[model samples]
Target: MKAMRDVWGQALVDQGAKDPRIVVLDGDLANSTKVDKFAKAHPERFFQMGIAEQNMVGVAAGLASIGQVPWTSTFAVFLTHRAADQIRMLVAQTGANVKLAGSYSGLLIGAVGKTHLDVQDIAIMRAMPDMTVLAPGDNTELLAMMEWANAYDGPVYLRLARDPVPDIFGADYTFEVGKVRVLREGAGVALVTTGTQLSRVVEAADLLATAGLNPTLVHVPSIKPLDADGLRAAVGGHDLVVTVEEHSVLGGLGGLVAETLTATGPAARIERIGLADTWGESADNAYMLNKHGLSPERIRDRVLTVANQVLASHVG
Candidate 1:
């Protein structure tokens, strides 16, 4: 297991070696975001932008305009909330080749408190017309997605967690934009999620299976431009579709799933498990997850209850 941010830092270094146009900008958080690795390796290509996230984004946009690929690194909350306007106007509007790496996203950054946590980043980025929002499940997937982002000539937002997570994909894994990967195949229930929460969902699926509630597990790495056909097919015959994330249910993965299902045919009952229109508190990883009803045991219990309710409704 490896931290996604560490993988991102190494991937940036590797990409920098191969692509001369690649440059990195940090908002006074090189050490925390793990972009310090790139700064050390390629000091000439690295820019220390201090705590000015907005200025960093603008600088990145300018660099991109000059045929350079610029990656801006900072906490997710600062990048998505503080520099939102600059990202929308300069990067998204112009379709700049700027990559935004939002480290320490979601509610797991306990030491930093809610001020540093960002549960609405997906909503902010996905709502942008030209932005590509991605949240890899693990380090291997993050590396693959970084490669894909490098090749794509547009604005990209990569949401990364703070700590290490179990590897969900192998070294041979290849990332395709706007696609979903089905990890497990079952019936009646579909457990769909994105980001690091996928590891917990996989565990919950195992517990569900033991309880005779075998579910179909789908991992959605690309939030924007979601694979509608793949999602629909994966949960077609399922009675319940549970969309989970380390984000808000409002306009994150859950919102994307709801929008997709409503736009397409074959309607199913959807349950969104995530932050519920509330702020996160500073706590340890286990406490935060259990409090947010995101732990493996909590997720399993909730899914089982919901599955039973669905069955009862069908009987009625």
Candidate 2:
């Protein structure tokens, strides 16, 4: 298991080495976001912008306008909430080639209190017109997505988790923009998820299989530019389609799925598992996840209940 933040930091350093056009800006969170490694490796290219997130984003936009690939790093809450206006006007509107790295995303950063937690970032970022929102499931996927973002020409938001998560992909894993990855094949139900919540959803799938549920597992790494046809093909025939994420059920993965499926045509019954439009509180990781119904056991139980209900309705 490896932390995605660590991989992201190292990837930035490696990318900087390859391309002199790459520069890094941090909102006084280099150590927390793991961008200090990049600062250490490339001092001249790194800019410490203190706690001013809006200014940092503006600087990044300016750098991008001058043919520099600028990557700005900060806490997800700070980046999304504090610098939202700048991001919308300078980066997204102008189509600046800026990469925004939002670390400590989701409900896991409870130790730092609710102020530091950011569960609505996906919704906010994906809502922007030209912003590319990405959430990687593991370290390998993060590295691949970072490389892709570096090469892509637009505003990109990379949502990263806090702690070390189990690896879901191998070293051979490659990330493509707007492609959904199918991890397991089964029947009746489709278990869909994104970001660090995937590992737990995998465990929940195993538990459901033991109980004869046998759901097909799908991972969505790119929230924006979602693979609509691929998603429809993956979950169309299933009786129950469940979308689980470490974000709020509203306007995140669940909302994206609903928007996509509803626009295309008729769709299967959809269920969303995540924070129910509530703010995060101070607590440990395990407790917070359980409280928010994101734990593997909790996910399994909820899915099983809904699956049984669907089965009964069909039988009746």
Candidate 3:
């Protein structure tokens, strides 16, 4: 298994070969962000914008105005927090055909701690009017999203985790923006997940099934422009909707699912499994995941607890 950024960088090079309108901009972290691959292959189309995150975003906006599909890559915290104002005013407001690649997102940055981790990026990016926020389940899905984003018009935010993840989608998997991937079929509880958290969610689904929870596993690849109907369809008939992610429970996948259910009035109760608007600390990936109740075992336990509760309520 390879990192999502690895697939993303190579995919950017592949897309560049086909689309001449594609341009890449890096925030002085090309090697770390993996955009260095694109810079080496297409130096003329690649722009090294130093460490000025805000200015780099501005430059991407300018390039987008001239019909170039500018892809800007940087650390997630820096790209979202450092350049939020520019992103809101320049890219989202104008609906520029720019794609923002936020690398090292969430608590997957191993020992980088909270200073570099981005836990609120999905919430911030999805809140934008024109931004299409995506968190691919694995590297293969990441490649699909990159190709789709290349052909897609307007602003997009690609949330990439730095950790290696298991392949959940098969070779025949096709990416549809705002669509969910049904990983497993069943009906009792729905395990809706995004990004690298999918690995744990899938494991949790199995554990839940062994415990007789009978979960329906679903992957939400597109958080923003989320498939409301698709989510409803996958989550329909389930007693509980458990949204999992490496982000905050407030405004990421959990919030988006809640909003959709509210708009449609689904009778499922949501138990958000993620950091509760808290910052991460310097620790090993497994330690951090366990600390935040994101481990597969923890998720499995949570699902069993919630599923039992719903079942007991029916019995009562």
Worst 10 residues of 1 by lDDT: 258-267
TM for every model, in the order presented, reads: 0.98, 0.99, 0.97
RMSD (Å) per prediction: 0.8, 0.8, 1.2
Pick the winner on lDDT between candidates 2 and 3. Answer: 2
Residue pairs in collision within model 2? none
Ranking by TM-score: 2, 1, 3
lDDT of 1 by residue, 20-132 (tens): 99999999999998899999999999999999999999999999999999999999999999999999999999999999999999989987886778899999999999889
Local accuracy of candidate 3 as per-residue lDDT tens digits, 1-316: 8877788888889899899999999999998888999999899999999999999999999999999999999999999999999999999999999999999998978686658978999989988898999988888888888889988988999999876789987888789998888889888788888988999888888887788777888888888887788888888888888988899898899998888887966468889999988888888988988999899899998888887898899899
- Candidate 3: lDDT over CA atoms? 0.89
**What would the per-residue lDDT of candidate 2 be over residues 184-269, giving only the tens digit for each residue?**
99889999999999999999999998888889999999999888999988888898999999999989999999888888777878
Q: What TM-score, to 2 decimals, does candidate 3 have?
A: 0.97
**Relative to the unseen true structure, what is the C-alpha lDDT of residue 107 in candidate 1, on a scale of 0 to 100?**
89
Clashes of 3: 0
